[model samples]
Target: MMTSRRDFLASAALLAAGLAVGPPLLAAPPKKYLGVQLYTVREAMEKDPAGTLARLASIGYNAVEGATYTGSQKFYGLTPSEFAALLKQNGLLMPSSHYRLGEEPTNGAPTLGTLLHGWDRAVDDAAAVGAKYMVCAYLAPAERGTLDHYKYVADQLNRAGERCQQAGLQLCYHNHDFEFVPQAGQRPFDLLLATDEKLVQLELDLYWATKAGQDPVALFRQHPGRFPLWHVKDMAKTPERAFTEVGNGVIDFKKIFAQAKQAGLHYFFVEQDTTPGSPFDSLTQSLAYIKKNLV
Candidate 1:
């Protein structure tokens, strides 16, 4: 088909202005979508969600995963659509969110229907913000006490996952080092793994697995495709083993990233829980390292 005069002139203007490369047939540019979990700059997000996202975009991050959504099912106090608009304005997208179940409801524990309804609403809001995954970010200490507890939660997660699937979303659990620790001679993580694989996917936090002395590669080998997301953080050399910016610590990220396909890594996010200086600077350093070595 012949191009119209207006289209041709527009194309010419874009090329002349250096705003676009050329016609799509000549070459198609790759889209770079580097991911960051917003919890890395929790303070900044709390202060100004919009500004923090703008800063992230300036740092070359195009994707974000939220780690905070509590009480009213809002993202940093803004409605889902409001937050989505802010993210769009800053050239960013949120693909995942950490929504907690919250301390297992004290007043005689809400009915299953009530829980699922809440999850449905959460899923709807998350979808409104263009998120694909609604992850159970953390489990409370009081909620987990024995093997039966893990089994029960697994069942709950399966039902929850079914509900999430109904809304065209995936449900997952993010783990910390505590899951590796034995409880009643069986690790809670193991119970989670034993759950219906299709129902409860895992989002592995690399630093915590390493800190707890578990090999991520081996886990991948054991359960391929179970882990689709990763929290890519590094552990410091301190005794407390605090989180540090990637590539400046003891973890072997290059080697781990080499096994990403084997580990079923669909998406990964840079998350440094303890940035000693400016979080933006730390994120920049981490992204630079990832671009040079891991990605």
Candidate 2:
């Protein structure tokens, strides 16, 4: 086809318009999805779960990790499906959840969502709730026995991991300072690491690890690609060594985040056990710092 003078002028005008706008915005690089652990606002969640989630969503958190699941088979008083719907309504996801070891009897029956009694059911519920990972949240005083018991815990975690894998989810163990404490001249955390890597992984709690005087980088180097989740909590610098906002604390996050690939990090959640002020305010501060300094 032959172009007329009018068509030529029109094409030139279009080119000029494009040039005036400057290059097309190379679609702003995808923003990293930051997450928060619900435990950070436990009291608020316990009182008003829905409101708490909305507040967190407003704070720019893209995901949330659950911190409670009782024998009642309810997450903050909502069933798995209901809770999942609530999360979606607020534009959030539950990538992971915390569960107990269930080593002891509560009311003469093992809790439903624990490793002891109803783990398969727990796994099923976790899947229902849109969770990709199930974590052994904490070990109570009685559950944390000698090194031999630690071996038992490892085996149990492997079994649970296998179950989770069958449901297309991963199982992880969330560590506290107790695991790093030397027991029988061997760190129980090391024993827990004995779990089959294919079945189980670690959700390294950066604050507790630092509080115990363990280097997060050293752990990453020691077990490369074995960690998938992280609790990005921070520790205070005072003598008491309390919990604090992420960047306000002494913990060196930039140094540890640099090793994220080695740590096999897929998701991380900010958490503060006991915030000094309003938890939401504290979270806002932490998220601001993270956005400014870290990822």
Quote the lDDT for 169 in model 1: 85
Look at candidate 2 and tell me the lDDT of residue 169: 94
Per-prediction TM-score to the true structure, in the order listed: 0.85, 0.89
Candidate 1: count the clashes.
0
Q: Looking at candidate 2, what is the lDDT of residue 281?
A: 94
TM-score result, candidate 2: 0.89
**Alpha-carbon error at 124 in model 1, in Å?**
0.8
Task: Please provide, for model 2 over 133-176, each residue's C-alpha lDDT reduced to its tens digit, 9 standing for 90 to 100.
Answer: 88888887788888998999999999999999999999989888
The residue pairs in collision within model 1 are none
Clashing pairs in 2: none
